[model samples]
Target chain A: MVKLTADNIEMRFGERLLYRFQHLSLAQNQTIHLQGDNGSGKTTLMKMFAGLIAPSSGEINIQGADSLPWWRRNPLLGKAVYLHQHPYLFEGSVAANLSYVHSLCEGDKATIMARTEQAAKLAQLDHLMQQNAANLSGGERQRLAIARAWIMQPKLLMLDEPTSNMDKLSQELVLTLIKDLQKQGTGMLISSHQACVLTQLCNQMWKIEQQGLTSTQHTPTMAKYSNTGQSQEFSYVTAS
Target chain B: MNDGWLALIQQALSLLFSLDPEVWSIVSVSFSVSFAALAITLIPSLILGFILAFGRFPGRWLVTNLIQTLQSIPTVVIGLLVYLMLTRMGPLGDLKWLFTQKGMILGQMLICAPVLVAMSQAAFTSVDRRAWETSRTLGASWARAVWTVCRELKVPLLMAIVAAFSRILTEVGCSMMVGGNIADVTRNIPTAIALETSKGDFAQAIALGLVLLILSLVLNFTLGTLRGKAEPRSH
Candidate 1:
């Protein structure tokens, strides 16, 4: 079992401190929806979790392994994957792009092909498997990027604004897939503005603002009136 | 002008087809020296280019500046300095490189190395950093990462080499000053053209000059095509 933990972390870029958090831990398979306004530290914190940026003053520890590299520190980084807003695609056909990622491995061709298909199905990208990825539409391209990330069999999946370009149906498919994947022990961190998408799937919505990150405790009582007239339950709006 | 051009073209074609041993020898020797110098430049420039692109050191800027400055130093000046060094009483006098094809090759290597380094560093820097980081994260060592980048940037790198070779092959001043146009020995196309033109043998010089222009054009065209092909594909 892999647990993600950060102890008293302060993040800084150049001479400016972005934000600081104390003891952020995910003990189980949790789907976290990070909600924040633009320029708030949501992306920054997600980047830190993805091991793309190291914390200025803190310790990120993978509870099981002591000396693994930062990526390995969180299994998501090793077996997990991060999909950026503008995902970088390799230059080639979909087959070439898929095969290129697997080419570095010592595995058999069948294994690679099977995993590619499996990922394509999970990400609802089976239709465009043969098309040149560069020629895909915006939503198709985002799904293709999702398919690419899924092919990695990540223990942790972090997405920055995934499905921002996807259609409503595609968004539901992705959200359902994320929930299913998380249920099977893959933790997901999705940063998106679609609050309605997460109302059903996300166990918790962590909001980030100029102040800091705050955990909204999701008790069963809160779930009863999610779509009802009780809209004033909590201060859920963050503007400016 | 048309009559003169037609006559020059006819004469050049005849000279080229006559199997004149002098033309053949100079062309052969020039290619040999140019290719030799180009081969010598490849390793040092690759190493230096990789360093300049990726390695950070205290004197990195200074070293790059010096190399770029050397690139602009006229070939004649390079020849004169080399001529001095390899002269009878100079530091490398015992080696006797002056007035030889070896001297020409050495001079061309100096002329081409900096160009290769500058172009290659630009090519390498243009590679995507994601590929670099991915290879490293996947357990490929530093050497492997560099090899991957090189493999991906092969076409651009080849174009740079071709451009360098073409430049060295067409340059006259250094080849003349150092090779001394030693009739059938160190004489190559450009230096021979210079001598032929100076002696008012416009026919022979025109033929050689036209060939030089053709070579330069072909190399430049190939470089442009290769660059176009390699750009969108570069990671």
Candidate 2:
């Protein structure tokens, strides 16, 4: 099955054109990691592929549907979930938050609870479900975000900085979930500055630089070589 | 007048609870017109504010500054400006909305639209960009993205509405001039206060004042609750 394709997608921010994409595709069951300096349009690229944005000048065909320039939502897209760097948690119970935008139909109370339980187990968020999502710690937030995506059973999963707020242990758990997703034939795209995200699990890694995306590989020297060498190369940071 | 304090207190209490057809008329009219005007401006201001804050359109700053200046223009000035164009002799005279509830609603919308735009824009602008990006990547449509942003900023939006409501409710000049404070017709809280005080009905004036205070309190309480729950990426 064709996973996803963004053909010649161009996005402009005012006079500055941000990205020009030509033939980017993800195969079913493949994992791709996106990397970039701050404001290099990594998030924009991810959002474009996620179908959240209109490319200024191109088309994004997903799962065989003709790419739409305007807002496009599909029931199948629910089969693909995007977890933002900072997940937008609704004001509600933990279970309610987990079910947000997720269309798990015809399920009884027990089934819903079971699925919720399973998702929490993968994200290790079971203990925190009853807690107010607003008060969750950073690590806890990431876990809940992933757990929500996990419950949706998306064929395509995209995560932006899933472990930015987590410690080594939490990051390891996130990576483990990615491994499971790839094993289950879910194509995953992760945008991260962290070296760990571009693991052996990811078949390809790409980086955004000067308004363009170039293929990158995180060798063993990823940590020591990444930001330290190009400290001055990217002086501008995207204000959160 | 002889029992000044007692009479004032009684008069105030009476004006508050008496709820004569006139008082009820005024109260209902006030709410209806202000509510109508607010409803009319809600979507426009929201969309304008959203685009101004988040969109990369040219001359966006000019629009923002112009709106800010318009917001600071006094309510009386707004009433005068509209009164001119809407008068029997003015351009849009055929509508015959002058001194009518609809007229007042139009005038007040002019007053409140800016507040709604500036405040709501600030609120929406304050929402984390991640929320927008996340919603976008989820393959949500523009409408869905806007709805997501609105939901995320619902607390602020609520507060902005209350602020606009309270601002219009207490302004005497517009309701008086534009609504003409017609007895048992277009009279509202502020206009009623003016009429009662001018007619030496200090007791009634005090009563209307008390009601206005209570209304303001309710509005504030609602805004406070929404602000509390509107956790905008506090984490």
**Fnat for every candidate:** 0.00, 0.46
What tens-digit string does per-residue lDDT give for candidate 1 at A1-240?
Answer: 667787888887778777777877654477777778877777677767766557898977655423545433333244335566666565557766566557544468898789788877876677777777667666666666666555554566677787665566566566656666777777777787544443445566777766457766443233322433222233343322
Expressed as tens digits, the lDDT of each residue in B1-235 for candidate 2 is 4788788988678766767666667778888888899899888998998998888988999999999999899899989988997899999899999999889999999999899999998998888776775565454556877887788778888888888878887887877888888887789888887888889878767777777788888878877877776554565
lDDT of 1 at A104: 43
Docking class of 2: acceptable
Q: Candidate 1 — which residues are off by over 4 angstroms?
A: A1-8, A22-30, A46-53, A57-80, A121-131, A169-184, A193-240, B2-4, B17-21, B43-64, B84-102, B123-159, B183-185, B223-235
Q: Which residue pairs clash within candidate 2? A: A52-B136, A79-A154, A79-A155
Candidate 1 residue-wise lDDT, B1-235, digit = tens = 6998788878876777786677778788888999999988898898899899888889989988888788789888888888888889989889999999898998898889988998888888887766664444333445666777786687778878887887799888889888999988899998898888889777787767766787778877876786675435311
Instruction: Fill in the DockQ of model 1.
Output: 0.22
DockQ, every prediction = 0.22, 0.28
Candidate 2 chain A TM-score vs. reference chain A: 0.79
TM-score of 1: 0.76
DockQ of 2: 0.28
Return the top candidate by DockQ. Answer: 2
